[model samples]
Target: MSCVQTFADYGFRALGIGERALPKTDITLCEQVVLIGSGMFWNIYFALLALLLGFVAASLVAFARNSTRAILWRPAAIFIFILRGSPLFLQFFLIYETFVLLPKVGFDLNLGFVDITVETRWLTRAWLGALIVLFLNTTAYTAQIFYGALRSVPKGEIEAALAMGMTPNQINRRIIWPTMLRLAWPSYTNEAIFLFHATALVFFSSFPAWQQKGDALYYASYFADKTFNPFVPYPIIAVFFIAFTLLIILIFGFFQRRLNRHL
Candidate 1:
């Protein structure tokens, strides 16, 4: 097929449109680009949502770990240890199995005024199941970074706040939190990049790619498998990833600069 023809066939393949099965032997360059690019949608989706949710969860975990009370710090420390100590690949498997063991029917939620059912079945799908894994994985990693950065926050600042008769909660809100984030921004930037790279593994792990709608690496590997040519598709995946990584760095770097402006 000509380049134009190949593009036409695979252009919408990623979206579950156009030719459904993907190209087999003698895959054209356009097919590789369009199909793989389509798959990139999943990568971006996973990275963005995971990072956003993870940042919030990590912030809470950081505070909990830093809390003086054993009630707060111990659980935070254990959660971080388990997630960080175990390989993410293994965690993916573990979480997927645990979810599978959940009642196939939805779980019931009781809010004093209303009862709602949350579906457990959705947890089996890669989009939601794999996302939850990445969310928690990045949360644990980012929390550690924030916790380390928290140590660098000035003790005098908190002391001064206390001297001024400020409550601990106020000190945390008005002083510690911002400083911790400012100090942690650089490290957190690295965590974000790593999480994006990890998105490629979502499909390869316990979560099966429903409808073959996987991430960039998944589709790239698919084409490589069919053509027995890793040289082309894999490089393509790397390039796409590099581009996204640079974009991430630029964004986070901007925040890093703003955070450090007072320095």
Candidate 2:
């Protein structure tokens, strides 16, 4: 097939928009490239969602871990330890099995004012269940980075804020928080890249790809399996991921610059 036609067919294969069946025989280079590139849609989706949502959870956990109160610190510390200590591969399996054991009909939520049904069957799918695992894992990992930065946020600066008659909330919001983020920016950037790379594990682990709509690595593996040629497919994925990671760094660098502007 011609290059354009090859792309036209497999370009959206990963999204299930075209090419219901992948190339079984005579897999061409264009097919591998296009299919694997298309699969990046899932990778970007998983990474973006996990990082954005995980940061909120991580920041809260970081604050809790840094808190002087044992009530808050202990639980945060324990949660971070459990997640950071365990392998993500095992976490995926454990979480998937736990979801499997839950009632397929889902659980009920009664808020007195309202009631909600939480679906559990969907948790077995990679899109949701693997996402939850990745989210929690990234939160725990990033929380430690933020907590360390929080600790190093210069007590003198905080005291200066207090001396200025600033309220605790004001100091935290206007001063401490920004400083913590500035200090943590480099590590935070690394965490974002790490989480993006980890998205490759989603299909490989407990969560099965519902309709062969897996991520970049998944399609790359599929092509490799069919062609019995790891060289083209694997390197294509490497190049894609490297380009994606560099873009991430550039975006994070923009934020890092903003954070350090006042310094």
Candidate 3:
């Protein structure tokens, strides 16, 4: 079968889609390509979900860091510094260890007459654990970008908004937030691209792949080990990642235009 056909058969099979078992022996280059491509799906999922969720948290952090009160400002500033200053690789390792140490039975909460058990074991897995790490990591990076943008917002805009009798929250929502996003878009684009590439480190960190299911780099590493040929699979993954990175740029570029529409 062709690579595409094989992918059709085993695409999400990692997640139990079509095939139950991955091909073992006589693995052709086509199989490698198809399987690695399939694995990229998870990478894309993590990056997109983390970025989308991180944006809101980042905005909140950015605003808090810029607050006049020292209480809000200090904690937010510390969070941004700690996450941004340390390597993301270390963060992943630390978070995974922390998650693993949590009780496998999960945590329980009693609210009035209702009792809820919150699962903690799943946080040790790559899907949820690594995602939480990536989410917090990206939030820190994006918050710093947004904080800088918030500082650089033109003084006249604030003055104009205040003159119009806008409330502090109204001024921020209408005038401040939009401009901050616009100003930060380019740098934020770069952060997002790097963050996607960083997802490769997930499997290598404390999180296990569970079975053979893994992201592109995980599979590419497997092929490299089996064939003793980093030359083929690794480069193929690089090209795929570069193409994926370009797609991210294009998508963000469209938003950049939309954000700057009034300007």
- Tens digits of per-residue lDDT for model 2, 1-263: 89899888888877788778888998888888899999999899989999999999998999999999999999999999999999999999999999999878967899999898878888998888989999999999999999999999999999999999999999988988889999999999999999999999999887887778888988998888888889999999999999999999999999999988876
What's the CA error at residue 26 for candidate 1, in Å? 3.3
Instruction: Give the Cα error of residue 179 in candidate 1, in Å.
Output: 0.6
> Candidate 1 — worst ten consecutive residues by lDDT sum?
9-18
- Candidate 1 lDDT for residue 58: 93
Candidate 2 TM-score to native:
0.94
lDDT of each: 0.89, 0.92, 0.89
The best candidate in terms of TM-score: 2
- Name every residue pair that clashes in candidate 2: none
Sequence-dependent TM-score of model 1 = 0.91
Query: What TM-score would each prediction reach against the true structure?
Result: 0.91, 0.94, 0.93
lDDT of 1 by residue, 157-223 (tens): 9999999999988998889989999888888889999999999999888898877777788899898
* 1-263 per-residue lDDT for model 3 (tens digits): 77778878777755657776777677788878877887898789889989999999999999999999999999999999999999998999888888878778867889989998878887988899999999999999999999999999999999999999999989999999998998899999999998999888888777898887889988888888888888989988988899999999999999999998877
Regions more than 4 Å wrong, model 2 = 106-118
Candidate 3 residue pairs in backbone clash: none
